[model samples]
Target chain A: MERLLAVRCPGLIEEDESGGVLRAFDRVVAAVEASCPWVTVVRTGICTLPIRGPARYFGGEHAVVDLVTAAAVEAVEAAAEAVEGGSSVEAVEVGIAEGTFAAVLAARTGTIVEPGGTTAFLAPFPLAVLGERDLADVLARLGITTLGAFAALPERHVLGRFGATGVACHAVATGRSGNLPGLADPGAGRRLHALRHPPPPPDRQPGFWGGASEADARAAQVLTRVQGLLGPDGVLTARLQGGRSPAERARDVPWSARSRAGRSGGTGSQPPWPGAIPPPAPLLVHRDRPAAELVGLDGTAVAVSGRGVLSGEPARLSVAGGPWERIAAWAGPWPTEERWWTRGHRRTARLQVVTAGTARLLVVERGSWQVEATYG
Target chain B: MFDSVAPGRVPGRVPGRTAAPASTTPGGRRDPSALAALDDLARRIRPTAASGTRLLPVHPALAPLLPEPGLRRGSAITVTAAPGLEGTLAVAMALVATASTGGSWCAVVGIADLGAVAVDGIGVDLERLAIVPRPGPHWAEAVAELVDGVDVVVVHPPFAPRPAAARRLVARARERQSVLVIVPGRAGWPEPPDVRLTVESSHWEGIERGAGHLRRRRLLVTGGGRRAAGRMRRCELWLPGEDAGPGVAGVAGVAGVAGVAGVAGVAGTSGASEPA
Candidate 1:
């Protein structure tokens, strides 16, 4: 089916002052995806390329156009709202026609031309819609205000007066033009699947929130729900009871406490906590891959065991640059003290040294002096 | 040199009327007749290119210590601190704040010891900041890459490196016009740098009252290099806010330094320091 799509940034001019136009566009795309599963939203500069394959697969021209129109409008509206300080002013202008050029002209001129009426729809538009203002103005000077007027002139006369641009405008106005095909069909049955599952039990709902007393059970239930939602994705978002969410709670808790609790409260004595989730290790992921350590520039890596035990010897260290000389002066085991009773146990040994030219602080466990953190 | 002539005896009006110069130039130009007058005026208004570039003014105490009195677009400077996390972080943060004010891109490479809040407290624009955690043994290479991409790259090297690698990185920094600030983790460098500022704790006070005070020892600057044999200068500085009047003072001590006194007019001693 042929579809008409209109994408616009009503507050585009004011975007600098209020921001969020791009974010709104994202939401608009999301909403469109949610509503019209078969319509693909193309994001070229000023125009959208709607492929006809999916439209044809679904049915015919009218159905595709309707889907495209609905999706486009919904997306634009949602995007406008998503923008910070966004309002209804950022409305989209949609126009549909048989040809890509015709459709683009119709959209720019705010006209929706009926199918097979591309020539008539484009006829009234000024040649400026063709994106050649100079030629359009020249034609208008000769009393050719609209495309139809310009096209009515002799072909030789247009060519003689305005060159290729004039001739192109004439051809499009007369309904004899060539451009790229419309968007292909966005495959039928290729919609994003949001699986519907049974709601949580009444006791697990926010209405039944029981502070601390039911915190563990509720947390477990939330995790189970998240796992179900994530499926094999391995990533999950869980909504917990109370004012704060589960993710917020996890971040607020200390890493040391979570790590030392040992999945079974440590001390080799207790059963694993029902819903405790361990924190991710402090792993630094770089966008670019790194080479193995070079002699002078490489830094030592020390490993610390749980319960503040030091393992292995202090290895060679890496250097980037700075005052390596001064840092070397005091390079040794430096103790760090932390209150173990606190929520997050943060006792560590900081070895200060300079390698290469940079000064760094390599943190080891206070008791063991094994590596924990590095300041580069 | 015209001073207010007290009740002059020269021309128009009363006995107290002061004579106005008949010449067009307020202070007569140096014709043979005007030579003495011009010489006297020259003594009154001597200009010296304002001493430093107004575009980028380094702290007075730091001016003499740096290769130039001000940091330019394409220059590398390093700050060193005593062994510990606190001092190194303080220096790194100060540099970040300084670079940010100049609208340059600043990145912390291989340094994850600081909390975001602490860095922010030192006035570093966190929004424009990019922090990279310790990238293991290949830190120098990572730092070189970062330096190429950013205006300033602050790296805290663990300990000594082979002399060859250190020289290579230094060449890279000079080629790219990127500032490489190395926070020394160990002691002794294979080569001396263009400029080096060593930081040591003189004293710290006000911890109990929640108002933290850091008193740093004198900044010892050594110029040239081992081969060239550089000059050494030491200076003391304190951070204090400028008052409504003209004079500058040390926050907790008397402003003794002579060279730094004149340029201490900037408000807020947050980043103030005297150049040696």
Candidate 2:
């Protein structure tokens, strides 16, 4: 499918006269990165840049066009948020086309064109898009209502009457004009990923595990493993039950969101039930040290598992105002068993205890206790 | 309260009306008559006339053009200007300054061209001023909506279809009892108005450095339209200080124009002919 996207940064001009426009431009670029990983942002401003590399990388001009359109929309949304006045920014219109001039013209007229159809699309557009005063007036007087009519006029006659502007307009109308020189290429193919997992229960079997006693822990481990496999560019698609059906859900996802999953391997599996697996634990890798210290201040005792924990030491530790305090009382090997279906790495033990000062609950899996969940 | 007309008297002086006292004073004691006269004077002075009118000070240049010396509680005036940055800023500042002094809430609709510095320099109360830029194609309706709440509304004319809409806006101003200043382009409209003042550039001599002072201006003012062809007057106005006090002086041989010179300064030139 061929698609064209136009992104707009509304209120950029009003927000900052000097450097704000450039900042807004950077924000749009960042938003496109976050949303549509496979698409590239072509030319930044009114100018046009080459798209040959992006088209070749995406396997054809059609796919590249679709990817560009999706990324542009995402970028526009991001730009809107980054703007000073928030969403109240003036109306911003975007247009995508096969040719640079055609795309710009479409944006001014609030329309988008299909790939390889620049000539057909330019037919209805007014000649005012050229941004030249003299040529526009002449075009209007020549009984030319649309760009198609202007382009159909004899090239020699047009050039003779209007000079360079007429020649440029005719070239753009025909979609055979070269990309404006000296402009930098916006780059190619964004990194997008999407993944979905099956619901947890009797009906939906775990990846390699079974049963409900330690299902939560098994599910957490499986998700962590999957995240590792996807690498940094990958995005997991978590499909919860309720609302729309799976078929409808696929169509409803925005192009950016669809593209996010493309980075991790194309498409991920869907949940067995509509609302099956419990929501994934928040991705808490690389938690800030200050945040960890503050968490310690809550006076909650947590149990830790894995290689960091030492055996026979009191598994319960209290997190109070400053650092972790090893609690002498309220210690026990709570014993958490996960992934019973899988051998060797199937089961694990976690300890549970409450701190003395705050009486907060903490869980430690295996041999160590780190502040996990705090209870009143 | 003491009664001013009453006086103290000695008891049994007449002796049952048998004989007059051997006092040679003619007309007896005049104390009673004097007290009565005093009482009459007191009663006359007790009640004073109440003043129902109030004085409002405005920019001296705009004073004569307004129906009252300054803007009153209910009056509509239209101010138009050229399209460039200088002209728009000049008109916006003047209107804002006038409204701010009167303690009236002012609103600028569809006037995005005004810069923040220009608005601040004009001393518009930011708390009282509301600027709505690009109010869309329905600018007239938007202005009308603001009319009910604001005391004054200054609207910049749209790129198209402005003249007829301006007349409707004037009517809206009257309906809401709010003053409306329409900033028009170069073309002057034929709309009938209570007062029309045309501002034109003139050579101003003796202006202090960095202070806005106009020593002379061709201010064409025509009052009374349709009902009466009011008097037309052309006057020269000079600014004496930063406080915007007028230093009016009479010019010779100017007809149909009132010449108001500083009475104190013209004491030596009493016989000078006043321009009228």
Candidate 3:
């Protein structure tokens, strides 16, 4: 999760008929930009900036908070002076937390929640803070009032009961995901651009080689229809992140959200993991790992020792207790140890075993074997 | 650069432009310069290299197994493996990799456990690829919708489809000019496709008795279909062949290439009417 700082102006939030409030908000943005170069406009009067780098440069989070608050207050005062009969500017609110959604709520009360404490801090807040009226009303009727109570529901159950948007809200409530689709206004930046520059006369001819290609537009149309048919989570796109195993390395992100962010797709630079298996990666990574057994020539169950060494050479393999096939060739016991100090620590070893015409990746942990993936 | 000057804003247009003399001499000789300029204009206004009626490009290695030029648009191709072989999914991914990377949109439906790394390794641009892991009962509807817009639609029906449903999808693909690549795993496709690619036999190399890593595998792919693609062609490929460039049959890992020498080189033969 990204640590972000949010700035909210209560006075200039609602726009007046004269556009004076927006101009005042723009002044506030300019003032904040002087201190942090990456200030992003979340909406008309709301903005956010990342705090990690600035916090380091300014000595600590506390010092950066103070600096940002001072800058925002000065800007509001200047804007208040410029507009005579406009909405009177009030004290600027600034706070820092992990993710823009939580940071915005933190800014409302000028509270800087500690890092890794976002879930606990957000626990007692009412469902209204989630900004979903119908969902909050329904959840309230079921006696789930607080965000923490709603977060306690199993993720699959939440997804089944409330659909994709509900699952997104549930993820935010649980601190598992930082982004909620409706939290950031997609057109806020374009709105600001329109304000900064008066429009030129509309051109008659279309620009050469501009906009999305015809194929992209058509694909977007059909994908949107698919989303409508099977809900937002049904249509997904894969994003590759750095991890040890194939499952951990790639995850399915909702296609609608991915497209809205306007990110040019491709795997970005990922940190090299030391123990990850080399890449002529398996074509099929089994989601439900079927149980398998690997036995030696003597029919004794083969296992991996504490030193990551195999007890015996595997000679036969059976998946889900199906008919056993001769293991013509095999390799590995790539051991991985995760979170050793925690109670949830796990140690497993993986092997590549081939049968007549099929090859599979097998993992053994605590003297049991399961098929992890298949080379096919 | 010339386009930067908007047409409406350009000055000095002759009022009698439509009434101008033809670019030909009195003796009916053509003006070479004017003809060249017209040809340049036509070329500039043509559709992009990847679009229009042009065939979708295939990977250099797999090109020999398909029709003369490349994969035909509005055609259906079924990729199936022999009863015990497991390289059908690998073969299917190889078939679509080139078209997907050429800026065409491809979607995979009903493939729940798709390995993204392997797909990326096969060179399919992830940006243009969409996946509907489980469409459930809306399988046909979802596939039909995608076929309308996507350049390629690959589906594995969770259940056996009614013959009518299969035929309708084939018709839709033809109408939309999209390629349909079906992997029909357990629930088989009822209608025959234009090109049917079967993985005859496959064997892993470079590993024995737990000594070395799983380097690569050699697959025997035989292409057979109806009409234009009826001729049977056999191709021996080293999928994810040594060196990480996926699905290049005879390229890279020269030592491993000779491992399948006895698989009968039938690529150039009049390969037709071989028993299925």
Q: Residue B84 of model 3: what lDDT?
A: 88
Candidate 3, residue A147: CA error in Å?
Answer: 72
Model 3: how far residue B219 lies from native, Å: 0.9
Instruction: Give the number of the best model, judged by TM-score.
Output: 3
DockQ of predicted candidate 1: 0.01
- Categorize the docking of model 2: incorrect
lDDT of 1: 0.39
Task: Write down the worst ten-residue block by lDDT for model 3 chain A.
Answer: A260-269
lDDT tens digits by residue: candidate 1, A287-340: 232221211224443444554333433334433332223222223333334455
Measured against the true chain A, the candidates' chain A TM-scores are 0.38, 0.38, 0.52
Model 1 residue-pair collision total: 65
State each model's CA lDDT, in order: 0.39, 0.38, 0.72
Give the alpha carbon lDDT tens digit for every residue of B1-276 in model 1.
111222222121111001112111222122354445533433332221122322244444444445555554334445665554234444445445555544444656555334332243333444334454544565665555554445566676664665645655665554444566666556545556665665543222111111222111222222332222245433333221121011232322333453454433342322122111
- Two-chain DockQ for each candidate model: 0.01, 0.01, 0.17
The TM-score that candidate 1 achieves is 0.31
Task: Give a tens-digit lDDT track for model 2, residues A1-376.
Answer: 1233444333332213222334455555554433332223333222222344455667865565456546545555655655565553434445567654555445445555666777787676555444344665777787875667887888898889978756876776666662322111221101000001111345564323523323233323422332233332221222212211112121111112112211122222222333211111111111111122212224443334454242443433424445554442332333444444668553333233323322222333332334442211
Please provide, for model 2 over B1-276, each residue's C-alpha lDDT reduced to its tens digit, 9 standing for 90 to 100: 000101212111211100111211122222455445534533332221112212223555435445556544324454542221122323334444545544445666655433322232233433334455455565665565555445566666555535445544565454444566655545544456544444332222222221222222122222222232254434333222112222233322342243453321211111110110
The top-ranked prediction according to DockQ is 3
Pairs that collide in candidate 3 are none
User: Fraction of native contacts in model 1?
Assistant: 0.00
